[model samples]
Target: MRDVLGKLGAFAGALLAVAGVIAVASFVIGLLSGRVSFGGLLVAVVGAALIAGVARLGKVPSLLGGYSALVYLGLFLPIVIVVIYAFNSGRYVTVWGGFSTASFSRALHDDAITSSILRSFRIGLTTSIVSTLLGTAAALALARARAGVRTPAEVVILLTVVVPEVVIAIATLIFFVNVGFELGTTTMFLGHCVFNVSLVTLIVRARFLSMGDSLEEASRDLGAGPISTFWQVTLPRLAPAILAGGLLAFTFSFDDVVISNFTSGAGHETWPLHILSALRFGLTPTLNAAATLMIGVTLVGLALAALALRIGSRQGAADFSTSTT
Candidate 1:
């Protein structure tokens, strides 16, 4: 009876979610038409209440209820917008006309777009590698150290993580201008690296902290040299955290606009710069198409990374638990 109730609750929650989504859509449609109706919003709220109620009954998995939902946001919204625009034939992106791929062709053939994409990709890749390597070192150094050193290391990590992106971007740009530093992709890349290094460090270190201390002790007890122990023991164990942190850093560098906007000099444009400039001239199909592509790539790639890591971590833990049992 309880199992049946659970399944029923889950189904009700799912249906309520669908209704809530439809209501939100109706509200948006009404909003775009110059006046939003309370009726549509009321319907959405009611549906959301039902969904929340069912979710509270303990039928829905928290992963589904929370983490997965949060993670899917970037993927879900972008996909919906991209699909809508992919079929839009009109010159204007906002007002739909009919289905066509003309905008996509323009985006592909655009030299400036291509150049910016290449620039962003190169920067993202380089930044990911450099940041991950340095950050992981910092993470490992903090994670493996004695108790006395850990608190300071943690404080440093927190400062970087919590600092505002705009502050760093503006500060770096000013410093460059004052010192006569040549502003280009290289500077942008390095600027991104600064934030990314801290981000990666904090993420990897968090993972390291979650993993208990037994492995390192075991390695030490085996009379293995520190280097050999780290290589054979710690690195393999730390690989997942490293990879996760690196993926996050790569995505950060790829999607960054604020920092890139401030640092990129005249005549040199990253994809973000192109998009931002184009927006001032009004929205275009080409911009949507290009943006759609980046959004899709980043969302799918990152989602897959998240899914893979989640599964692997769960399986590894399960295996460890079973063996211990």
Candidate 2:
């Protein structure tokens, strides 16, 4: 029954791929006649390629590949739809008048949107830096400590991860009020740092454990002090993980709405906060354009993080091999 079903699925996927290919070919022909714009033709080509790729996935040896294809569609189809609509000519987000750059222009030109975005970036960058520094230090301490000390500390730190974000936000708000600190960007930065430190600590500690203490010990044996060893040897090895943690922190800080809302002072709105407020008014294609830009930035950050990790691993391997030889 499973094998029969798989065959049927593959046949359906193949049919879809053929349809996409034909549509793309028609768009290309129209492009040559100056009937189709280059952007439209490019989009058609990419869509057809994606459809063919999925169809190829469906034909893989196991059922897992087919399942993955379904998951991919479910996850990204809505995003693709929204991205397509971001270029809508009309003010209404859903009603597609045609491909237009008006929304992109409005979104970029709007003073509130641009200012909020700049504010968000400032907060995100500040939070990530402070959290990364503190977390890296904590991770080093915990990783080198005795089991009795490390185990309890690990649980305490990871508790932040397990706790709900809303709960954390509320707790932070109460703490700020009790401490007599006015809710503002500083408070938001503090809240973000608290959560991100634990995240960074976990990532850095994992990397430390995996890489072992050999390099640090070698540095020490060569008469480098602890600080020098850490700066020269340990930190370089942990650079990829640290970068990944910082990127994660930046993303979370930038995207945070609930916490930012609870803690933001008068006249201080982050980009997410601006979007949330805009939703109360009818959503516009401008909002969609903003969202699409945010998604693009996030994807770029993730790609860089992945690339950094890959390069760091290769460099570490090369260094280890040279040392051994």
| Candidate maximizing TM-score | 2
| Per-residue alpha-carbon lDDT of candidate 1 for residues 1-325, written as tens digits (9 for 90 to 100) | 9967655555556656666666767777778997766777787678667656655654447325443444466567866886678658985688898888888898899999999999989999999999999998888788769878988877776776688889989999999999998999888998999889988888888888898868888989989887998798778788898997888888889889989999998877888888888889988888888887777777798789889989988998998899899
Per-candidate TM-scores read 0.73, 0.78
lDDT of 2 by residue, 181-279 (tens): 998899999888878999899999999999989878888999999899988999887988898888888888998887898899788899999998999
Give the best candidate by lDDT. Answer: 2
Alpha-carbon shift of residue 288 in model 1 (angstroms): 1.1
Please give the RMSD of candidate 2 to the true structure.
Answer: 12.1
User: What's the true lDDT of residue 125 in model 1?
Assistant: 95
- List residue ranges in candidate 1 displaced over 4 A: 1-79, 144-148, 303-325
Given candidate 1, what's the lDDT at residue 274?
88
Candidate 1 TM-score, C-alpha based: 0.73
lDDT of 2 at 116: 96
